[model samples]
Target: MTKPNILHESPSQTAGPYVHIGCAPNFVGIQMYGGKDLASNMLDPETSGERITLTGTITDGDGKLVLDGLVEIWQADANGVYPSAADTSGTADPHFTGFGRCPTNLDTGIYQFQTIKPGQTKMRDGRAQAPHITMWIVARGINIGLQTRVYFPDESANATDPLLQSVPEDRRHTLIAHKLDDQTYQFNIVLQGDEETVFLDI
Candidate 1:
């Protein structure tokens, strides 16, 4: 009997130019979904927490701005509760979605998010994690979305965070955001090079 030829799996492809058209139509002026983009607003008036603004630029291996990148963030609420069915710690803020998404500005290549500073959340093993936001990024040339964490500077809890501790001491700095003011933070993401931000596999 002749041996059968095996088909190899198809290689992953980049996000492509149409990413914004489908993921954030309002951004590209497509005016879909009632003219509003999902995750554009993470909170309402009744949301509880210290409102904060996260702004940054995404740069490539050559230090060039990634003008078409899209960023998404997921985090727990102010009281360390997540708005998910799997979370049994406590009820999360009903007015806060705990998730957000934004595309880099075409003109300036900057992305920003207005949300609350999350509180420390417990890990599956019951250890407390530092207050941080889980960030995911995708762009024209990215075959797969990049995942990372945005840890706040000067948080004492960071010293004991299990995930943070797992990262190399020197590279751990890449995970921290710079505080610009009381409510503003800057967290630049470098796709590659000497200052490349550390990305998580998951």
Candidate 2:
């Protein structure tokens, strides 16, 4: 008889304050560990595209922010091409890295990512998807990191985005970012309660 192959699930751990220590050693006064941390910047001065700043706070149900939360975002280049070698659609901007990371400020509980405004990318069905930034968040009390996407309220594509259309109309606003200025945006992440951000399965 063949033995049943049952695998034991490993326990999940909440990302604690030490995530900053392990991921961003230099930011917390720790040095000499390795090369330029996992992600200190999303691009160089020569990167192509309209650079923008994304700022937001991750808060609990009561509106209190998670000061230690860490945020990571991924997006395509200005032309809607990804930088990965596997991207066969076209060549992404050579200067764009397409990824960024930021840890929330200890006092203000705000996290900021400076990167270019992402262009629309393609979905598996060959349909053009809306321009957006996908984000992952982690903090002390979060057993598993939460995943969400940020959409621009001013973008015309948001009206027909397949993903956005899938979400209930009333709750879709939680994922849209508020334009603070020509080059700045605010997209808060709510962990619980009525205003919880829409977390994706992946």
Candidate 3:
């Protein structure tokens, strides 16, 4: 019998050391893209809403910081509308991109983004979701990027959010970003061990 022309799938690889070079060239002082990294700033003066800053560190299973990690966030505008073509509401803030990216500071091992606090959004099933930001993280040893959400603490809607409620009571705190101030929040991500953040498969 003739052997089938089988094409094997390539094995997955981790985001190597060069991830910063390709994803955020300016981070390594390459001076590309007008000397700024993509999604480095998610806001402009005209972007509507209360401006806020998010800061976090990514820690590995051994409690060591992942200094070279990259974090990206996607969130709806303050009016609960997404600035995407897929958002048919036609009410999304034109000045808000609803996305941001930052590479971890080599020395501090922290990533930060300046953005507006997202408003409550609805789930596919028409359930109201609490204000949250979707986060994607990648680093040297992470074979596949990890995905999670940063839900603001003290939001009344959190009690009814479908996704937040789906998480176990003990693990739900892993998804919340603690308020550091009126305009800042901190959300450290633990990649393993007892306090591992609740990652979503999606």
Candidate 4:
């Protein structure tokens, strides 16, 4: 076999050790930068709507907990308004920060987020989407952060969500968070396997 004369593009890279020091310094107890680390907490008492807590662990294809994984979530306020300036649907809750980041516990590989349950938002096609939280994951061996959505299993709007409808019926349950209590939800993410969560491209 003949080798190529010119070099090609390099392959993608994994999260490695940098994702910890760079994205979540506080979690590891090496606070270099000022202020709170990314994904520390989503809101304070001033934020309106139903307060909720989400806890879970990141597992690999072999089902081992990934203690070093980092997660980021973006969602609309309780009133379904994004913090972005482009949102013209209405005014979003001034007290709510719709974005959050958190790293898994080093010992147990568990992660947590405190925020309000997001309200339903409209899709670009004008259909009202189900109340859902957008999530991103970065960890060792993952060249690119995987994307997914967390939908409330009890939400009435879930039936007609454009994205939910796109997923096959058999795999839809992976996207829905199970209710642990009135104010808590459990949603674990599986990187790969027969029961892997439904990851998205965008």
Candidate 5:
């Protein structure tokens, strides 16, 4: 599918990393369903991966220049289905909008998002449960994209998840996230190398 155009913004110097433990905000917890105070699954998170003008810069450990980073992500619907392809009552689910975009942030890293976490599917091996969510990532200098599945750490099902199992034990910690507060989340991403994340080839 052709990529979508995203609203552009100059990289803000204000964005900071969640490096200091306890320095991150106390994120509000979100239930998977649309209930009382929760945001409906209508928020869009999409951006570009190739062009620095499209994606933003990525900051290093010292909050330095990490450029040309492209990121792409896919997620299931609120009902979790490769959400973009979902239809409802022959009309389409108005509440369920499947979206994807690659937008660069002030830090020079491309940001991409699609609505809904994919429903848990068994890995080819057929041995575990799978959790899902909107995946966000920053890559190295626009040549390749990094892949990491954002998962809720509190989910009881994560323990039995098959895809989680596919990840090496030492690296599994990167997949889990703590609820910092409502609307925003706080999680640290580990890039590959001496301090690398398990990035996907595609």
Candidate 6:
């Protein structure tokens, strides 16, 4: 499928606002929490239940790895429940692990995740299901951080999902996933490319 043009915000232009422009600094101490709780509570005798091996590469407009960029991902366990007041205030679900952040090493682009697949999320409109993974991205030159979701291509429900549908149909493919294998999926986000990943104001 052809990618959408975002630079031309005009209706006739047919492109959305550009994303992943410059880059940001590598801040070592900027830690933040996420909305949902998807941590594994079941302790492993060998190590902590949390998976720290979530790995992947951040590619640039030329399909080059942005080695110095940082990526953070947060999601619920396979159950699709987030860490919220409904379960416990100021805390996350014991069974539903809540947060994970990893900085890219020397590769300038590869990242890894030792976590399981995220479950289906409740639709904002209360009538549909959406499956995705939330990612907060920061590069070396960019000042403002980018917030977006990495959606699964196999999730057929996304066709009718509200959040997915809210984006123009031409831009919807940005959220789609590229399967690497049965156990791993690759989603290359673009700050500015043919099809930039969809970013929400919230």
Per-residue accuracy of model 2 over 26-71 as CA lDDT, tens digit each: 7787874664677778888889899899999999998898999999
Ten contiguous residues with the weakest lDDT in model 6: 14-23
lDDT of 3 by residue, 45-99 (tens): 9999999999999999999999999999999999999999887755899899999
**TM-scores of all candidate predictions against the true structure:** 0.93, 0.92, 0.93, 0.91, 0.52, 0.66
The alpha-carbon root-mean-square deviation between model 6 and the true structure, to one decimal in Å, is 10.1
Q: What is the lDDT of residue 18 in candidate 6?
A: 24
Q: How many clashes in candidate 6?
A: 36
Please state the error at residue 131 of candidate 2 in Å. 0.3
Q: Give one digit per residue, the lDDT tens place, for model 6 in 1-202.
A: 3358746443322112221121112223223233222221222334323332344566667766676666677776555666655532134345544555555554445655566566666655567557677888776655566788777777878888777888888988877767776666777777778766777767
Q: How close to the true structure is residue 12 of candidate 3, measured as C-alpha lDDT?
A: 66
Task: Write model 1 residue lDDT over 1-202, tens digit each, in one string.
Answer: 3357966657667888678998999999898999899999998988999999999999999989999999999999999999999999999899999999999999899999999999999988999999999999999989988999999999999999999999998899999999999999999999999899999986
Which candidate leads the pack in lDDT? Answer: 1
lDDT of 5 by residue, 31-125 (tens): 32332222222343442111111112334555555433333445544333443333221333344444343433425343333243435544446
Clash count per candidate: 0, 0, 0, 1, 37, 36
- lDDT (0 to 1) per candidate: 0.94, 0.89, 0.92, 0.89, 0.43, 0.59
Candidate 4 lDDT, 52-126, residue by residue in tens? 998899899998999889899999999899988989988989888899998888889898999999998998889
Question: After superposition on all CA atoms, how large is the RMSD of candidate 1?
Answer: 4.2
Candidate 2 local accuracy as lDDT?
0.89
Worst 10 residues of 1 by lDDT: 1-10
